[model samples]
Target: MSYSVESVAYWYLSKEEMSPKKLQKILYYAYSWFLTLQNESSDELENKLFEENFEAWVHGPVINSVYDQYRHYGYKEIDKFEGDLPKFDSEALDVMEQVWEVYGGYSGNELENITHQESPWLNARKGYQPLDRCRNEIEDKDIFECYIQRVN
Candidate 1:
């Protein structure tokens, strides 16, 4: 049951008030963890949750489509969600919950700061200036490796 990035973002928003910047960072973290968990369990890649491509943007990893959806909120909390939440299976829900538990406590800027210190975002932003706007997609493999390293 693959979810659209918006659906996943909406799920997160439904759980708490989050800024667009925080939402983007959390979405990237959730996606990265999903890939890592699925691979570790020997699940097929097709069973992975979301397919949204996270680009290494100036603020860290971002899904442009999700960003456009929530951009109106600016740096403010998204108080309301208009979309229906998707029916996520137990495994998906479990993973999402864990992702939230591990990364949800941080502020948007903190999440961005954490990503900046991680290899996946750093590698993607390689050769780019600190504030340069980049569209380089953070590869799923890199995401998995980075998170798995921390988990082990």
Candidate 2:
């Protein structure tokens, strides 16, 4: 079963208040590992939790849509989600849980520094300088391949 990015975002926000940047990084990691492990488990792209693409933003990978949804909040911690919690498949929930366990401690800036050194973000920003404005879409193939190689 798949879930929307908003649903996943809410799940993260539900655990702790976070800046939009932190939310975006957590979501990216969740999606990355889920994509990597899901393929090894089932070998199918159709099982992706969300279809939304992430742009290689200066801070890191950002889902433009999700970022826009919280842009008004600026750098402050986004308000706690007021909506009822959403449901998830066991596998999806596990992936999210594991993602939090691994990444929840880092602040937005720390995660940004970490992603800056990663291949997916680096490849997407290819030919672009550190401060260059870029919105190049990070390919799912590159994300999956790059992350899978690192993990295995």
Best by TM-score: 2
Candidate 2 lDDT over residue span 27-55, tens digit each: 99999888887885423556677889889
lDDT of 1 by residue, 1-152 (tens): 67787678888988889898989988888888888877863234555678778899999999888888778888889985666788888888999999999989999999999999999999999999998989999977787778787777
Q: After superposition, how far is residue 73 of candidate 2 from its true place, in Å?
A: 1.1
Reference-based TM-score of each model? 0.91, 0.93
Residue pairs with backbone atoms closer than 3 Å in model 1 (clashes):
none
| Off by more than 4 A, model 1 | 40-45, 82-84
Which stretches of candidate 2 lie above 4 Å from their native place? 41-44
The global C-alpha lDDT for each of the candidates, from Candidate 1 onward, is 0.85, 0.89
Candidate 2 lDDT: 0.89
